[model samples]
Target: MTTNATPRLAPGPRGTFLLGNLLDLRRDLIGFLRQVSGEYGDIVRFTVAGFTVHLVTHPDHLRHVLQVNSRNYDKQSHEYRPLKLAFGEGLFTSDGDFWKKQRRLMQPAFHRQRILALGEHIVRDVVERVDAWQPYAQRGESLDVAAEMVALSMNVATKSLFSTGLRGDEEVTTIARNLDTVIGYCLYRTMVPFAPPPRVPTRRNREFTAAMTSLDGIIYRIIGERREHGGDTYDLLSMLLEARDEETGEGMPDKQMRDEIATLLLGGYETTSNQLSWAWYELSRNPDVEARLHEELDRVLGDRLPTVADVPRLEYTNRILEETLRLYPVPWLERRAAATDSIGGYHVKAGSLIYISPYLTHRHPDFWAEPERFDPDRFTPERSADRPRFAYFPFGGGPRLCIGNRLAQLEAQLTLATIAQRYRLRLVPDHPVEAKMQVTTSPRYGLRMTLEPRRPAA
Candidate 1:
């Protein structure tokens, strides 16, 4: 770990002579990373398109990159450049003083009290959505759980962001579809190093542009309306408009507001939805976990709707979410070395890409016993006390940690409790459930499930 020592690259797979690990990476991102990290150890170094990349998986190493020496690692890298197409210079892709300023201005919106208030609306919304699933349950028809969660999460995110949900199901579907297009394109660009720029007008580029335009039109229209007709609103949009920089006493400009809003919508909606989709899949596969979840709901909720006050008592429900995140972390962490550094006794050059996988770290045998098991008890205080903090960072860590972590958790916890109270989601037989790596982790093939009603809807 001493920087003064002679520099040495970390051990890693010896890929192709010309392309290095590019083919392997593009073929299977998550699987490739997991294989290399498992084979070569924590600080695995490899080349992709002539770039020296390091896959750091140890908890201590992750802590160094994410927290202790976080300043040395930042998002100003090629990995984040593609995201700028959709997110612009928002918190997700922005760095340095600007990111700090935005984070400060927006931090209050996600505070404990703010999320608590939002939790009530989230639960109500989830209850209505879950009730709507009754028809499908009664018909015994398989429902695409992935799409369902995306739509539900979009509604929740829209409400939290604007204090009003999307106009209707059509608009929600349209916006969600556009978001997928733009995000999928961005991910494609990131993975394909030599892909054409946006200006090149490739078929995919055109689609990305169209999707972005649609999204921008909707977002700008809302911002304009909100600005012209300012009202007493408790959503994040209103807060951003009202937020004044402590140093300059200036409010966020429209462009900045748009970027931040886009970031939140993308971050909050897709991540929560994917996590929920996976949660249902896991629940279906593990009836024991589902039974315990139902037990907790019955004891704590008892045919009543869950509220923010009940969140604490729904301990098992929260653990399920934690376990899901551990198994399949969305938008896995990536950073570029801003300067030369030493990690896990290996030298990391400036501009070297550092990839950390919560998926892999969560499964590290040293820290997690039977790491692949879907046991929520792994997150219990007694069990987790000895684990490293970075061993389970689905939302990341450090100053750049996700601002809406609490809100996302609350949304998932309440939505799960609400739905579990009414029905159990069982994956359709012979259905293949494979994790797809996009802007966030998602099911490669949409998750289709048959819902079994547990009790009559209220």
Candidate 2:
């Protein structure tokens, strides 16, 4: 409603006069941005890839831009186009009416009830994965926790979203692996955060396209089967196929279906994987926190597999995961452009872009004391009441908030607790825990660690 041009919140000096701080951001993105927050205050500006962006740290301003008054903003299509090539026109990137229809129709699949019903399967599958890791422990092999988390999360998505038939399908792995590259390539590489189109057909891009082809074939066949069967199944695909207008009965078309699958695969896989990796990293660092997590699990399920009902009681494990996300948000920052005449008193040119960095916002000194310190206690009941709602936005906010938010938390809590109940991971000596600020802020060197088996309960 108001647009104030704060001369105080201005862009930095880097790159070329025209080019801006593009290279600076691309070089060491997290460090550079953190330094920016330290130097210029939270709500400042900088250039990247020839675009001017406003970095907002104030929770109120962010809530305004992302949620409260979000009609003025939409998902950055300039950003989503690369994904469009892989996903078509699905939810993650699509805008306006089409996005609305897809959002509403897709709602039931991720409904709280639906996700809770599938929670047992999520807990069980994760336990099996951890059991498989016992051999790695036996061989005295170090672990790439990042890759393992990705693999686990991908399987979780398959189980809950796709149903039993799609779980562990060869085509599904190909899709996930291909998407792993595409996300890191396109969203986290350039100073401006985009991957260039393949010009002469390099091995990386070719592999992505090939994987997409296989995935598309699988999804297409599934959609075709859904059409033939006439809305018979309650799985995600059938939900989308049967989704209709509240007033007019119209289902999502093939193109939208393709985009949604791509969106889900990309958005679903990376964020959860990165979160689990970081949680493992933190758990390795803080043995005290890990022990407490173990205590909670021991008291709760006590050797039995966790049920959906047990999730709410797994509060400590969930807090550890939430704290992990606060330290290392997968997306790092979300960019959007103004759709209307203004933001506050500033005359936001219709096409002007803006950035709301949860990475920066989360570490605000005012909201979080000793912000850089890793303290999960902030999430405890009394302390959590001290902050505003959008102050910690790992899954983002608003109607555009991640549809998979609850589902992701369910998987993380269940998986980490299930693993902690048996095996404990020790940080490997001299291994660097470097973060790659790519599509998601993944551990660049991979989270290499040693595993120790817990003493069995008497």
Candidate 3:
């Protein structure tokens, strides 16, 4: 019995019979979690609907749940099953051989060299979009970077993964807007973890399904055309189509193809875009940091777009993104279900779920000094080297680490270096930056700012 060998962590109070901690999640997700972690110690527990979820705060415990004891866990059907209804067996919600197979198939495509080949597209998009803001910059007009950040990142992912650009064409624009809505709705509802499948008539459900339909139609058409036309290309779709398991040499089926594309659709752009949006917000508030970023960009990149080779040289840009991920990791929480009964000083029940909150670990006082401040130096080469391996995991750790990790990093560093080389963004006065618990941690109020083109480098 669970009561007999009581685990060190125990469930604390949640809420009344009617509401649950739903109010905390609704009003301010990150703030509420921070309050709970500060009040409770490293391993905090709570109950909702007769279920217990443990929120692990300490970095060591985080790795214990996410990395060390990773094998003891699966993605769990609660998180995996509903997503399967839409994404099917894609990497984001898959386990066992399906995830293993997909990870192997797609890993080669994101190799540093292969991803570096996508750099030109990264520069062109960052330049065009950031340059398009010139008029606003010239007129001293403010911009809400929330949507702009999405547009910027969508362009990067669209270019790298889709191997196409987003023109202002009616159909492409419509499908993108619709697709974003549907994906957001489905992902957010997965929080409940046990709801019945959303039906066609539910407004959000309809949009998600409709958007998937429209987009899938387009992608399938493209694949068909590519097959017929038969040109050599290096995009992710092409890689997936051609990749063979190193040992078995088998490829994914057509149905799996849709899932793979849907995986990138749901998992790719939002995380990096939100990260950049937050970086923009953080940089604007901390002028000294922004100045240091500008100095690094000017000294390293000047006005020319940074190539992938310039990535390591643009150290500050990398650190800014690092700091951003620390504060607003796209995945605020990651969960795992125990696959085996295990004992140490503690026992992990086979069926129990473990929740690891990076949001809390990154801010915990035991590890980080002045944990709330926006300090890129926290991730400096020397400082970060001294920290524990799992202390700063913006990307989830272990083999199941994000497949798109390199591609995302390549995009963020190049795009930030590219754009920051071109303009200085000033947070507009009194523009409220509030958090929203969306598919990712997002800005509901929109991050508004004024943009001014940087003077040309001598």
Candidate 4:
């Protein structure tokens, strides 16, 4: 649609005298975004320290911004500056030819067939972790489900990236811890816009630098070791090691490979782990849904574990994961700036930031009925047929959509099915579960739950 006249200003809540909406955004971003989406219309325009910001909730607008005219909206927006700090110009941060080249090199590693092949590894990781959970179950010990999922996903990530388990590998564990430290620091930096620069010798900065140093040391050590022992390895590192640019017929540089691997570890592990943790939280609260999930698992696998082949038949399990993603997507908010254009009758000037929050859109009242309810059936084919594709973009949409989407889904589905087959994770009574918005959204207090071995199906 074209605007014949000057476009009206998009409506939004007024902010404080000088800071604009900066404080509100920093305080409770998710809650503030929700209020703004409900109070203002689909395209809410707000200001942050005099810069215009637009929050887009409608699907058509999302499609237009993300897919149809994506080139105009680049990833170099200020919102991604923190991530760029942590990951450099890896696939998660790069744009243009650089991004395309990296994507091409990394594409083969995350192909559907390749992702499917990794399922056995994923299941093995899940089974090993679950087998150990029996001791906690027997002792009536309360396990932090969120931490458990983190460990599980971390194992799966290391195995996927290095083709080896990291259970007792302190060097790799140090790398993982350092990555978490960096992620935490990045989250802090992203939230507090006025925070001191990293180069400053502040306590946080020093810790962040130390973490980066440790992380770099581990990643470089692994790269050097892989080069020394390089015959053929099926891990993603090996794939990157061997990947060649079509034009130059040259392999990626060590720096580039390190960035990609670091990006994959952060993306692959944190998002999947958070989602799986949230899934357990939801399942514990919703017994009916859990019952249906169990019924599907019982009917499909009997006493055996879930494999890649069982992914399709575990329809309800997949729906449960889909619903969990709808509620608690790890990357809850995304930002892009208009290179140039108009959207939904609003004149989006060049360099204005547009906020595309799947968290808000997924729970949009207009799109989803009873938006707060946790019902996995919302993802059933019949129910899902009527919604716009952009209305539920958990992995996002368009070309920059998450490269590991299929792998994440496969891993979560397999992990969920495998665990549900053997044990039930129930939340501890009166335990508070709050959403913590780090670089990825996760449980605030961590999900405290007790595990019980499920009786065999008769």
Candidate 5:
């Protein structure tokens, strides 16, 4: 049934003859994308120096690219290069056989049961951290909620990975600081095409190199220490160390172990933290939704900290998180280099690039009602049942769907529910909310908010 009609060129804004939409894309990626999709229908083609970039907005089209014919789209996208430099050949960066092997070895750690079992530990970390925030609440202090979540998520992720929390760990602190430097540097280069190489002896290059060296030193130290204390343990570190290929009975090499752990550090905490930050921002902006969330938490737990068993009952809380992700997905854009394919009847020759944004696709008018508004009920089972499977993929889809998705959900839900049980966050008056797009979507100016202790459910 395939038609031989040549697909019409995707509509987009006219830019300088040679640059096409490159300037718009680099200047304001989020706003530029919204403009393109808003005006140009579902598929947008923007040519940059003779290179055609396709941004697919429809759910069915996304599924085709991410799930159905995913084999034709490898992880050789331009966006992945910076991440590959940061993470090396880890599960998040590798492809084909290597990715498959790493994914298999790590799958058991993130099993539903295991993720559920870790709920108590996650709450304990949240409780410990939030307890300290109480003093600021009492003093009416405005705190950077985004930074707070980053710190909290780092502790949770590290604890989950190593069975040792990062609180009071100077080495981890230094490593995290350097990771920030590297991520910011990489993001800038990705957007600004003419940026100099990292090898140049500029101040920025030196900083990036120093950060990478510091990160490497800390990671290698941890790996060496783990090797010295070898024994079977339930943490991800031990699991990775002990796992062997079923056929060859070979374990992951030390370098791979480091890569996977680094992958955990980069991907694990960053997205969940950003998601929670945006969730709080949305909650603060919508009092009615916040009230409903509180009511749900009150009815579900009645002052008890949320457990994995209670997550299903905290339906509204989950909805808020879902809605937040819809508005601001962590990894906003997914890029792939097409390997001889066609999308929406358009011939996608080899070397062509495809861009899919959960941030944009989740807000596509065809799939979402009032796409710009914050509406948690949009995620209610009845409402969501009719939507295409790819319409709401915060964790992505298909073989490359994020392996840590279940764990992230459990972590976010538990953390949000636990905090909602005890505190309500309010944004500082006139504080502007803006997204700073990088590998993850973060608040441009950190979300500044004051905490108010909520009354216990009667």
Candidate 6:
């Protein structure tokens, strides 16, 4: 069924003469992508300042780039350079043999057993955080659900990484504020091709440098304390310190440890918080789905907090998370062709930028029935059996998949179940929630919602 004909460029929008599609892309990234993918077929070729870029939305093509011929495409693209400014050469930004070794050392810490054991900590944190919302529910005051999720997720990340939460509210607020600046700057740099380099003393660069410095001070201080008073601990930091290379039998260097910790903090909290925020947004809009979720949680969990063993039984809750991811996949994947290649009969030249958008692909009409509709039942085993493997890849696919995927899922499932057991979040009327593309897909105006207390099913 495959074609071996001479390769040609894929069809795409004829962009502006000088800047290509840069203006349209900057104007509205997700909308522009959806527009083009709807008009053109799967492999849409566009130019940005004469740089050839291919937006591959087909599942088969995505598999070819992310899995089948993964070695031919790598993270050496311009997309990841901004990330390296904050993450350094950590797992998120590293490649080749160095990446392989790092993955090996960190793999044991993320094992299923280890993650399951962390469920107690995750649930406890979620319980404390959600309980604090009682005042909001009692007074019927609207709270920014987006900001709440971010703070809660950051607390969970710190607990998991260091086995302790931030020292106090002020510290947590400071870290979260700085992270916003850092992430916002990185996103601006990534989207704006002509952005000034970090070395230049621009206001953005200066702010980014200050924010990174504050974050590094915290990270290195943790590393330094661990080294001074080393002890047995179950946290990720301890594991990283103990991890030794099989070949060289060496522990991670301080600089590398800082980089990895920063990467984990950035990756761990941001995506899950955004996903949870979106889940609340959708549940408020779809009462039936929300009702079913509550029914399942009540039937399975009764009056007790959810445990790791109960995750499988909470099928509907997990499905809600899956559905949310389908609609709002955070990270848009980018890779560069290390060598000349062919994709769907299109000749992809060496060094060409290959863009595979999960946001677009997840909603591909060919694969998803009523793709925009929020339906958790679509993920049932019977329904999902025939779907393309690469079609629903929110955590991405293949070897370079997001390392903390399982941990993120567990945290989300547990947090959602715990909070839904106590209260239901209702979106504020006419709040105008819109998906904004940044480092992640998040609400442009933070999700403001009021909470209603739910009684246990008798």
Error of 5 at 431 (Å): 1.8
Mind sharing the TM-score for model 2?
A: 0.90
Q: Model 3: runs farther than 4 Å from truth? A: 1-11, 14-29, 165-172, 191-196, 340-344, 456-458
* Residue 447 shift from truth in candidate 3, angstroms: 2.1
TM-score of 1: 0.96
Task: Give me the displacement of residue 158 in model 6, in angstroms.
Answer: 1.1
RMSD of 3: 3.0
Model 6 per-residue lDDT tens digits across residues 1-458: 77786668789988989789988878887788888889998999998777889999999999999999999989987778888888898998998889989999999889898888889999988888877888888899999999999998988888788885346666666777878888888778787757988889999999999999998888888888889988777789988989999988999999999999989988888899999999999999999999999999989999999999999999999999999999999647789999999999889999889988999999999889999999999999999999999999999888988899999999999999998998889999999988887668889899999999897322
**Residue 115 error for model 4, in Å?**
1.0
Give TM per candidate: 0.96, 0.90, 0.91, 0.95, 0.94, 0.96
- What is the TM-score of candidate 4? 0.95
Local distance difference test, per candidate?
0.88, 0.74, 0.74, 0.85, 0.82, 0.89
lDDT tens digits by residue: candidate 3, 1-458: 35675456543456667566656656776777777777877666665454555667677776676678677678773545566767778888778776887787888877778888888788878877776787787789988888888877766666666575234445445645756766666666666654445664766667677877787776676666655675577677777778887888777677787778767866677898888899988998899999999999878876676998899898888989999989888546546565544322344556665666677778778789999899999887788777876677778888778778888888999888877877787888888787665557788788888987777532
What is candidate 3's TM-score against the reference? 0.91
The pairs that clash in candidate 3 are 72-339, 182-208
Clashing pairs in 4: none
Error of 6 at 349 (Å): 0.5
Q: Write the per-residue lDDT of candidate 1 for residues 47-88, one digit (tens) a residue.
A: 887778999889999999999999999887767988998898
Regions of candidate 5 where Cα sits further than 4 Å from its true position: 1-8, 165-167, 192-197, 456-458
